[model samples]
Structures are given as structure tokens and as C-alpha cells.
Target chain A: MNKQSLVYTVIFTFIVSFVFVTLLALANDGTKERVQLNQELNRQRAILNALNIDYNGPQDVQDKFQNVEQIERDGVTLYRTTVDGETIYAKEFTGSGLWGLIRGYLAVTANMDRTIGIEILSHNETPGLGGRIDEPWFKQQLRNEKIVDGTIRVDGAGDGDTNHDNGQIDAITGASRTSDAMRTILSRELSTFQQILGGNS
Target chain B: MSSPGQILKENLWTNNPIFMQVLGICSALAVTNLLTNTMIMTIGVTFVTAMSNLTVSLLKGLIPRKVRMIVQTLIIAFYVIIVDILLRAYLPDISRALGPYVGLIITNCIIMGRAEAFAQSNPPLISMWDGATSGFGYMAVLLVIAFFRELLGFGTLFGIQVLPDAFVPWTIMVTAPSAFFFLGIIIWIGKSIMNREGAPA
Candidate 1:
């Protein structure tokens, strides 16, 4: 009942802290497996979506992902899928954006000469501006575009003259930094992919 | 002391958190761009507020005067983490969609306000009701704003196309600035209605 007593405050604080921490630890333990599974599933789904593969649910994802093989070639992780006797590859890309790291999947054709598709997995870009990079319209620009000499250009100037044959894409209007970041990421990742796949092909 | 029904009515309409008290507008503006995100955020906020209120009320008798705020904050944070974990485990898609906003629920003023003003003095059951009704009030306003934003911005409600093909989506409504105008208009309309109802006959 002594509101001013230091002992009471200390004891109360300790008890509350102890109880809540224990509760959180227990909840975290309970959800650990499920959370990890969900995260893994999400990553797989992003990879599949980037490859333009159709999947409906977790079961479908697993079934379709069965065709994809994960390989660590020259310290770079690549996902390879063979459909109708042609191989397609996807690799995770992480690069600096305007605010933080932008992570995504880059799917390349069998010869590593063209991009099959691109899917942004996560980014800390400012919403509504740089964040528009995650929108389908922006990503669609990277789909089926040729990757020339392990480089891609993002046209920052509002010129609609981006050459698809030369691996050039238009940047989101208000997200020049993010677009530039994406360009840097794709260039860097393409070199890595070429190195990993160079000896095999 | 007010009756339980009066408390519910007061929180839901007369003293609504968003339109009346304006207690938690941060999440409102951030997540109301999409109806789905708003709904998920509303549920998460409601869970944290109700559970935190109940926990705070139960411990009110033993809480010291100087440390009550700290204790309340601990409870709120604990519940918020639980919500985050559960969402990651069971509703990973929504969890990822919400990003850091779920964690931000711990800092929402409405939960702390209820804990200090109502839960610290009321019974656990009543405090829970008050917390839940406050959340519901906040959610109602957010959903209304989201309805207009998503409908006009994305030309969809709950991700379904309701607007005709001839309708052009408003680009501004998909951004945070759009929520400001929508929320302001709703607050204006809500206040005029409340004022009329409160006027002398």
C-alpha cells in the first residue's frame, strides 16, 4: 500500500517485466515454426511468380516449386526450373534503395541473355513514390527484356525512348532514386548470374 | 458511472476516437489506402486495446501510482507483440502487407488513454468493453475513409471491381495525402451531425 516506497516499485516492476517477458517468450516459441514456414512459402511464391508460373495455394506452390531446383553455384544461390525442355533461372537480388535495402527476384531465361520476369520481394522505399517499384506496371517493364552485357539502364529522364533491345527501362516518375537503385541491383546481379552460369553453358 | 450501453454508444459515436477524440490518426492515414490493409490494422488494434485494457484493469489494484504508466505500457507492448506474432504465424500475407504498423500499435494513444483514464479506475469487464468499443469506433471511421479511398483510387472495394470500366481511378486517393482530405471531410460531417443532435429542441 506504500505508493512512495522504492522497494514496492522495484518489486512491481520486476514482477510485471518477468511475467510479460515469459508470456512473450512462450508465444514466440509457439509461433516460431509457423512463422518460418510462412516466410519460406512467401519467398517461394515470389520466385514462382517472378518465373511466371501459376500457383494457387501452399499445396500448389509446393507442387509447382518441385520443378525448381535450388543450387549454390560460386556462392550465389540460384533457382532453376525446367519446363518443356527449357531451363529458366531465378536469383534473389538485394541492393540499396533510397531508404534501405530493396530485395527481389530476378528470373532469367535459359541462356541468361533475357529476363523472364521480376518480382519485388521487399523494400523500404517511401510509400507512393519509390514504393511504386513494387507495382505491376513498373515490374512489367523488366519482363522479357534482354539483359545485355550484364547491365540494364533505367532512364531517369522522362524520355519514352527506353530501348528494350539494349536493356533499358523507364523509371517510375517520382522514384528516380529507387529506379536507379533497381538498375544497379540488376546490373550487379546479372554479373553474378553470368559468373555462376558461365562454365555450365 | 455510465451504463455499459452508454459507454459503448459514447465511444462508438459521441466520443469516437478518430472523429471526436482524434486519438489515433497515424495508422489511419498510413493503412487506409486499401480496404484490406485497413481491416487488418483495425483487427490488430482492436485486439491489442481490448486485451491491454483487461490486463491493466486486473493489475490496477496492485499498481503503484508512479509506475502505473510504465506498467500499462508494458501490457500494451506485450499484447501488440502477441498480435504481431499471431499475424505472422496465421495471417502472414496480411502481416507482411501491414509491415511495421502492427508493431506501431503499441504506441497508439487510444490504448494508453483508455488504460490510464478508464481501465485504471474501472472493473476489468467494463474496461475491456470500453477498449473494444473505442477500437470499433476507430475502425468504423477508418473503414469509411478506406471505402472512399480504395473505391476511387483502385476502383475496387475489398479488391473487387465495383466501378465500371468507364470510370477512371483517382491516382491521388491511393496515396497518404488522399486520406487526409477524406478523414477531414468525414470529421466535418460527423461533427455537424453530432452538433445537430446535441442542440436544444
Candidate 2:
């Protein structure tokens, strides 16, 4: 039982790990369902955000989300909400970012020519650089931008077109890779979004 | 063995992890933008630090010298995950706002530092007391910083309107840069007081 012995080290390490890990495993299991519900509620909040729905808190998020109808068309899941008689469709989208995967919801008008809004659900980009995608101004810029076949471009302000009136939304400064990734995610998802609504409607 | 009163004073003031040891600064800067968030975040840190220190102290004699670091890490991570899961379930909004910082608590040096310096040599109860007080030390500074940041940045205290109508929010205070000024000032004031006390023990 010498503490310095290699065998003791191995046994002691195993025992210590087992004790702490078992505690963690129990905690994880106990809260697994509640955590998943919270995560789902977060996605629900993002959907509401994309649709420009105002919610005061998690309770309101739950209540407001009640009006949202989940629809699956051709394997595409869309969150449907009617706001002031206009039908907005929100669908989850994912793409590669500079550091890791980017996940979010993209809401659009039924016609799919303009985005209602976009809410980044998760990302792994560097903080203050690509991570600015989650900033209010950055995401706010995506609101009501015209898009056809998801052809929206996220490039430099004056690279090709500076006009946000068109489908060109300004990319984040110093985050070209992440911006390009956003473009790829939206353009690809939007076209498919168009199809999802186009077929269902 | 240190008296409980001395441990509390040292951790809360003289030997504070944040002020004296200068540990756990990253979270101090990141979460202090809002008082409510800072409170919850620091409380979580406190709980994890206390429990981890207790467990580490209790198992110190049984732990292998060669694998002690790994054991301490497992112990800390276990408590952090429990705190994270609890937050996700109970305070989902704050949990989302705090985001990766909660999980990042596992990397906070204060926990490991306590486990190594105090917990390894101290009895379980005192180790836990030292750990908790250290967290309070960290919390006291962060709360002060957060109070100013939230007040000036948003004209609010704990999300309530505190400033008068004429008050104009300082936009810079809400950003990351604001934390530096507050942290530097706090550190300067703390060190000055310590210097006036005449000598480092």
C-alpha cells in the first residue's frame, strides 16, 4: 500500500476516478431530461427570435411557442408561426465555421424571397472575431434582407455590392471565414427552405 | 491548522484568490457585465470549490502522488458538471447567458490551487471552508465590478432601473474593455491596502 508505488498509483488513480466519475454520472442522469428540455427551449427561443416574436422569459417562451406548429415536409422540419396574419417559416441550419460547426435557425417569408431573421443557436468561432456573429448588430443585419434561391451573400461591405437592399449582407470585419461560412449555411438552407415551403404550400 | 475565522478573513480579503493570488480573472471579466449573472456564476463557483476541496482533502491520503493532478481535475470537473446541469434545469436563461463559462469553471485555477495548497494538507471541513471563502473572495470583487458595469453600462442595478432619466448609459461599459479598468482599479486598491498593512506574511 506504498503511496509511491506504481501499482498503488494505478489502483489509487482508478479508485479516485471511479468515485468522482460515479457522482458526476449520477448527477448527469438525474438532470438529463431537464437539461434536454432547456436545450429544446433554447431552440424554441431561437425560432421565436427569427420570427420576431417577443417573449419576456422562459414561461413566455413556452407560452409564445405554443402558437408555433412543427411541420415536416420532405424531411425538412419547419417551425411555423403566424404573426399578424403573415406566415413565417423557420428551419434549423448548420454549416462549418472557421473553428467548428455553426448551427442556427433561419426564418423566412412564405414566398422565401426575404429573410424574416436569423438566430445563431450555437457556434465555436473565436470570441470577439467570428464570435461577433452572435452580436445583436450582426444578426440584426440579417433581418428582412432580400434573398432569391438563398443567393444571399455575406461579403465585405463594398467587395461586390455594399447595398443591403440587395441580397448582400455585410460580413463581420476580421471574420471572413466565419462570414463565408454563414453565407454557405444560409444560401444552402434558404434554397432548401424555399423548396420546403414551396412544396407544402 | 488555521482557525475558521482566519481562513474566512484570508480568503475573503487578505489572501483572496482573485485579489491576493490573482486567480480566476478570466471569469471575473467575462461574467461581471450583469450583476445577476455574476451572482449566479460566482455562487456556482463557490459551491464547486467547496465540494471539490472537501473531496480532495478527504481523499488526499489515499491519492497516489504521481496521479494527484488528474484526480484533483476529475474531482473539480465532477462538481462543475453538476453545477452546470443544475443551472440548465433551473435557471436556463442565465445558464444560456453564462454559456461555456460554466463548463470553463473546470479550468479555473482557484479550484485546483486550493485543492493542492490548502485541501491536500488541511482537514476536510477546514479545506471546504477555505475553498468556500476563497470563492466568496472572488465573488466579492466580481460583484463590485459587476455592480459598476451594470449600473453605468445599462443604468440599471441587477437589471432594475437605478439611474435617473438624465442618465445616459456608457456604451463602452458593457463591452469587454470596461472590465479591464474596473479590475485594474480593484487590484490597485487591494494591493495598496495590503502594502499599508506593512508586510506580506
Candidate 3:
């Protein structure tokens, strides 16, 4: 009965921890299914975004995704979508950022020479710095750019030219490392995708 | 002994956790770039603080003094994990937007500070109210900062474009340093108001 006694302390700790852990376990169990669904939905949405498709909600995402064919070739899962008899391919990519992993969907045109668009699914880069990669302005630069000779050149901010014609996109002002990493990841992954697509590029 | 109303006022204004006491500033700075993010973070912190405080106060009588801190931390962490799970399950978009900041709520000082200073001695109801009010106070300050940040930095409020098309966004306001300035100015203004009302600055 003594509050200061070791037995009482041990019992109190055990009871408190047991109660909370049980509550947490119940909560985790309750939300596990929905959480998985949400993740799947986000992945689908990202793929849709990379294809430059307009989607409203979960139903829209599902309906749009229905038109896309999933093909796994050489350890890479490619999402192929056909619109007006023209085909587009999107592949998931993960690469090291300045702080952590940067993940996204990279979609290219039927010829595999020009990009359709890119949608960053998730990233752990520094917010407001490297994180700006997810911003419309930054990602817009990559869209419709030509991947020349299997390489994409990224120019630093304030350089002589900020044009995307030569496959160069301007880097974020304070996130040069992340910009460089993104460029490298795109080039490397693009080459890999080209090989998987029978060296079309 | 203070009444519940008094406790609420003290924590919410006179001894505000963010502006007046300046206890928890890390998350305030990190997530205040967007009003939606700040709102989600505020709700999460409030839930954790109030629940942890209530739990700690209920067990205050039986807790061994030597292990009180460890017990408090465990309780806070337990509640935080529950919040994280719920967010991931129900509000996947906000959860993903928050990233690890939700998990980092365990390290937020306001929760631990209230548990140690108020919850350890107060009744459960009072402790819960105190914790919730403290969190609300923190939220109020952060929302003010986020208003300016989102407005000027992104030309949006709660992701809605409220600014006119001619408005130019301030890129600096989107970064972390802008939060520092905004928070500093807010604290200064709050202190000045308090001093004018004959309270210690």
C-alpha cells in the first residue's frame, strides 16, 4: 500500500503501461486497413499526375488507373497508358536526396525521348529548400523536356541560361545538392528504363 | 488553489506556452509554413498533451518520485503514437504532409513541462484542462505566423488562392527563417500588449 515501496512502483508502472499499450494496439488495428488504402491511393494518384491526367477523388483515380497497364520488366514496374492511340510509360523512382530518400513517378512519351511529366510522391528533403522540388514551378521544368543522349542536364539557379530546351532545369536556390541528385537520378533511371524498353531511346 | 477557468486563462494568455512561456518552438517553426499543417499539428499536440496530462495526474498519487519522469515520458509517447496511427488511418493526406513532425511530438517540451510542473500536483481534470489550454495557446501563435507565411509566401490561405493574380509571392516567407522573424515579431507585440495592461513583460 506504500506509494514509495518498490512493489507498488512496479505494479503502478506495469498497470499504466499495460493500459496505454492496449489502447495504442486497438487504435493501430482499427486504422491499419484504411492507412494501407490511403497509401495505395496516393501511389495511384502520383502515377496519374505523372501522366498529366486530371483526377478528382479516389473513384477518379481508380477509373483513370484502369486504363493504365502494369508491366514489370527487369525489376522495374512500368505503368503504360494509352490515349488516342498514343502510349505513355511511367516508372517509380527512388533516389538519395540531400537529407534522405526522394521518391516519385517519372512518365515519358511513347518515343521515350520527351518526358510527359513528373510527380513527386514522397520525399524527406529539407522543407522550403530541397523540398521545393515538389513545387509546381520546379517540377514543371522537367515536363516535356527532351532527354538528350540518355542524360538530363540541370543548371544551377542564376546561371547564364534557365532554359529547358537543352534538357537543363534550374536548381532550387538553396538546394544545389538535391537538384544535382535529382538530375543524376533521372538520367540513371531513364537509361535503365530505356534498356527495359528494348533500347528505344 | 486556482479555479479551472483561471488555469485556462493563465495557460492560454498570461503564461502562454509559445508566446509568453516560449516552451515549445521547434514544431511551431517547422510546420507553420502552411495553415493546414499548423492546424493538424496543433490538434495532435493538444490530444497528446491533454491525454498524457490526465493520465499522469490520475497516477500522481501512486507514482514513485524516482521514476516519475520516465513514467511521464512513456505516457506522453503512448498518446503520441496513438495520434500518429489515427492520422495515418483517417487523414492520410495530412499525415503524409506532416511527415515525422507528428512522431517528434514526443519530444515537444510543452507536454513534458506541464506533466512535471502542473500534472504532478494537480487533479486529473485540472491537469487535462491546463495541458489542452497550453496547446491551444501554442496553436494560436503558430496560426498567426502561418497566416502571414502562407499568404505572402505562397499567395494562398489554407491552400486557397486568396491573393489577386497581380500579387507576387515572397519566396523567403516560405522558408524556415521567415517563421523565426514572424514568431519574434509576434512575441514582441504580445509582450508589449501585456506590459501596457500592467502585467510583467
Candidate 4:
């Protein structure tokens, strides 16, 4: 192809491709708000689930979680709350796991030392193993655990016994690394939450 | 002229992407732990691939020979973004389960490979058919893998228990690496079947 023809082809291709992509973006604009709302609602649901609070859908979610207030620190969103008699604060934390990042919410009781519950908001672990952490059976073990001493461990199977020396949650079988990563992340996040909620408490 | 039945046989089974060509293995490995995630991921890939193929083929005549690949990539990325946005809005849970893997579909070799090899040379309608059919082929393999994965890994399929109380679950079947093994086994079985049919190159 000649230089002039090649230039024309390039220009034409650029224009067409640009126009097509722009149109797609424009079409997506209509659904963007719904997407944002869905994401926010899903996050609220996960946090509520971590706290053992359940609602069917969006309207149910709104009815139960009517009051949401932001907790800011140094211009950053440290945590947020939904007031439903008991104030539940959702704190975010991230850490390196066996494969990739493990990000989650650790919801605390009003006193801050007791864990209301925990939920994995995002993770990149091996599926079927680390991914099992997303299951409720694994998460439910966190409820009512004292965050001050709660330590996640993988040891030989024992009777479901509570040891107060450290808050103990039965680790998921075959997902030791991922469970350990969660423990490390939650401990670190709870300490920070304590610092943030210290004055108020 | 080749009949539609012949083409369907070729695309759907004889030359299946996941079982035979082994394209798009990333999603197969990542999302097959749960039947629901596997289903949604299949639909998302089908939408992105078909739309990308259609757009690419439509512009093939106008695309510069030198920059055809770049143009194809732009078209594919546009479709992927559209699918990603829609999933985030409508299927928040599955989207969250998919994580960055949905956006990573932009780099899914199946979409790109189809555009460069088939879509760029075919008419838009044919390319769309090819993309959708190839996605089905891909889903066929993933579902087979997921069937076993969800069954042995969780003692269930689609969260419904199929195993009697005596059957112990296999933990390894649910992880991403297990998909590698499953894909290998599926490919081996497929190759053997093709070889019995005179090994058409």
C-alpha cells in the first residue's frame, strides 16, 4: 500500500473504532447507576451476612439498614455504619494471600472488641479451596468471637471447644493458607478499627 | 456447499475449544467450582465473543491490513466492557464471584483468536455464529469439568447433594489446579475419539 493510502486506512480505522467504542460507552451510561446501586447493595448484604443479619432483596435491605453514616479519618473513609438498634461498622482490610490479594470486611460490635462477623468482599485464591472461604459455613464461625484474642488456627480436629486464651474459629479444611491469611488480615484490621473507634467508645 | 449440520457438528463437538483447542482455560479454571458461576461466566463469554466477532467482521473490509489486529483488539475490548458493566448491574453476586476475571476477558485468547482467525475473514453473520458456537463448545467442556468438580468437591451439584452419606467428598476437585487436570483428561479423551475417526488435521 502507498503511504497516502496507508494513512487513509489508519485514519478510517481509528475513526470507526473510536466511534464504535464511544457508542458502547454511551449505551452503558444508562445502566451505570443501576450497576453502582447493585454493587452498594451487594456490599451491604455481604456485611450484613457477616453480622448474621439477613434480608431478602433491595427493599428488604433498605428496610433493615435504614441508617448509614460514614466514619472518616484524615479525609479517608475508615468505616461505615448502618444503624438498626445496634450500630454495625464495616471496616475494610487487604492482605497478601497464598495466590493473590484477600480483601474483606470485618464488622465489629459496638464495643469494638467483639466481632459481629466477617465477610470476604474479594479474593484471588484457588477456587474450591481458598474460595470456600466465601461459604457461610466458614464465615458463621466468626460470629460472637472476641476480636481482642480471636486467633484463627489449623490444628488436629478437636471437639468444638472454646479456649478463651485466644478467640478460636474452626478453620476451613484444606484451605489452611487462605484461612491463615484471613486471620492475619482480620487481626490487623481489628486493631486499626480499635484505634478509630477508641475515642467514641 | 457444507450443510449447517456439518458446521454445527464441527463447532459444537468435533473441534470444541475447551475440550479440543483448550482456549479460554483461565475462566474454566477459575469459575467452575460452583455451577452458578460457571453458568454466568459462560453467558458473559458468549456475549463478548459473539459481539466482538460481529463487530470485527463488519469492519474487516474497512480495516487497514497493517493495523487489523489492533482494530480487532479495540472491538473485542469494547464488547468485554459492555458485558462487564451489564453483569455488575444485573448479577452483582456472580460479578463479585468473577472478580477481575470478568474484565480479564478482554485478554481471553478465545475472543482474540476467533477475531484474527475466523471473524476477520468471514461475514459478520457467520462470524457471530462462529463466536457463539465456539462459546457453547467452551461451555460444554467447562460444564463437564464443573459437574465433577461440584460433585466430588462439595458432595453436590448446583448445591444439591447427589452423594449418599457414605461417599466422602474429594477436596482437590474444586480448586483451580484440578481444572487443569480435568481439562487434560477431557482433551485426552477428545483426542482419542478424534484419532479413532482418522485424525483429521
Model 3 agreement with the true structure over A76-157: per-residue lDDT tens digits: 7899988667788999999999888899999987677777788998888876678888888888887778878876777768
Report the Cα lDDT for residue A44, model 2.
86
Which prediction has more favorable TM-score, 2 or 3?
3
Q: What DockQ does each candidate score versus the true complex, computed on alpha carbons?
A: 0.65, 0.43, 0.69, 0.57
The order of the candidates by DockQ, greatest first, is: 3, 1, 4, 2
- Candidate 2 per-residue lDDT, tens place, B103-164, comes to 99999999999999999998999999999998899999999999999998878998889899
Write one digit per residue (lDDT tens) for candidate 2, span A28-126: 898889888888888889999998899997899999999999988798788988888888899888899999989989898897778888899888886
Worst 10 residues of 1 chain B by lDDT: B192-201
User: What residue runs in model 4 are displaced by over 4 Å at the alpha carbon?
Assistant: A1-4, A67-90, A94-96, A111-113, A146-166, A189-201, B164-167, B198-201
Cα lDDT of all candidates, in order?
A: 0.87, 0.86, 0.87, 0.75
lDDT of 3 by residue, B39-96 (tens): 9999899989999999999988878997899999999999899889988988898998
Best-performing candidate as measured by DockQ: 3
Candidate 1's residue-wise lDDT over A22-116, tens digit each? 99999999999989989889999999988989888899998898989999877878899986777889999889999999898999876777888
Question: Candidate 2 at A172: error in angstroms?
Answer: 8.0
Q: Give the DockQ-based CAPRI class for model 3.
A: medium
**Candidate 4, pairs of clashing residues:** A149-A167
TM-score of 1: 0.92
lDDT of the structure predicted as candidate 4: 0.75
Alpha-carbon interface RMSD for all candidates, in angstroms: 1.6, 3.2, 1.6, 2.5
